[model samples]
Target: MNRQIERWRTWVWVLPAVVLLVVFVYYPIVDNIRLSFFSWSAFSTSPAFVGLDNYTTAATDPVFWHSLWNNVLYAVISLIFQVGLALVLAAVLEEVVHQRLRGILRTIYFIPATISITVAGILFSFVYNPQIGLLNRALGAVGLGSLAQDWLGNPQTAIFGVIGMSQWQSIGYTAVLFVVAIQRIPRELYEAAKVDGAGHVRTFLSVTIPLLREMTTLVVILTMSGAFLVFNEIMVMTAGGPSNSSQVLNTWLYHNAFLTDDMGYASAIGTVIFVITFSISAAQILITRRRRVQW
Candidate 1:
């Protein structure tokens, strides 16, 4: 009787969350699938079914392809700069930095992360302004006025500019994660490495990175997901700009569903995005497992 009562209590506690998931999460997912099979709710007087036409259209859309390629590029670039730089920063902070300075540095690094992505986008818009932007000012100061071309306005450099801001915003967050992982390493191992005359580089190669393999894998997976989901920055800064050069999957989906009132097509795009992100995350886990160094 007592165990039954306890189990009932546990279930009662879980009821709210379960109900919320069914309503907010599961329901929307089912509704999205249903909407995707028909024209948008806004467009149709009675939710007219269009079968596979939406999928067919999205599959052949050039904009969709461009957005996909752009997302891939963004993911790759963000991983390299964000996670790679974070690892380096973690290493430096762990070994060389003093305690107070480390805290200050972390705060400074994380400031960009605390701000809204949209705000960051707007701020960068000013910085990338062709006429009086800070970048052009800096270039002119260095007697490189010829090089001060339009950044966000130019299709060639706009995506790259977004990538830079995204990377900068992400680096500190990744660094903090790495710092947490690095701190978990046993001091005894580090001491043993020191006794063995293993210097900083050797200790890092042998002890630090190998110990944080799981964390590295986690960071890679999360960063890839976030990069693929990028919307606000592109939306605020370039709005898929100078000729759709900065368009990503999320932005493309938004334009389809909200702008074009094509819910079915957007659903197909969303589903595709979900599949790609899941596949990449799975691949990261598998690769990490294969490569994880055993201590």
Candidate 2:
């Protein structure tokens, strides 16, 4: 009787969360998957089951492919700038002897992350403006005027400009995560490294980098997922303009669903994104589990 009561208590505590997840998360996901197989515009009275036609349309769309490639590029850039640079910044900050200075610098770096993405996009758009932008003016002042072109207007540079702004916003957040991970490292290991005459670079490469493997994996997953879902900045700054050169998967999905009124195709894109992200997450879990067992 007591065990039954205890089990009932457990269910009572867990049931609300389960209900919420089913209603908000699982139901929507299942509905989206169902909708992907149907043909429906926003104006349609009812959805018509079209089988794999929506998926076929998405697969053959050249703009979808372009947007997908752009997302891949964003992921690569995020991995390099957000993860790599954050690691370096975290290492430097961790080694700083002055606590006050370190705290100030970290706060400064992280300030940009707290700003709204819409604001950042608008601010960067101004910075990238050709005629009166700070970037062009600075370059001209430094006798590097030739390097300054239409940053957001040009097809070649538009995506990269967006990427640079994203990195500026996110690198600090990534660095903070790395800093926390670095703080958890055992002090004895650092002392031992010092006793063994391992200099800063050698110690970082050997002790720090090796210990940070799990954190790096976490950051990669987060940064890559964010890259795949990037939309606001592109929407605000470029709207996937200049012939869709800066288009990403999320932006393209938005364009199709709302602007073009192709809800079925948008659902298909959403399904594809879910699959890709889910597979990556599952792979990461498996790899982490294996590594844990090996360790």
lDDT of 1 by residue, 21-69 (tens): 9999788777777777786646566877888888888778998998998
Per-residue lDDT of model 2, residues 1-295, tens digit only: 9999999999999999999999999999999999999999988998999999998998899999999999999999999989998999999898754777899898998999999999999999999999999999999999999999999999999999999999999999999999999999999999999999998899899999989989988998898888888989899999998899999889989999999999999999999898888887788878987998998
Q: In model 2, which residue pairs have backbone atoms overlapping below 3 Å?
A: none
For candidate 2, give the lDDT of residue 239: 96
After superposing candidate 1, which stretches have Cα over 4 Å from the reference? 285-295
Supply candidate 2's per-residue lDDT for 294. 95
Give the per-residue Cα lDDT of candidate 2 at 21: 100
- Cand. 1 Cα-lDDT: 0.87
RMSD of each: 2.2, 1.2
Candidate 1 lands at a TM-score of 0.92
Q: Would you estimate the TM-scores of all the predictions?
A: 0.92, 0.97
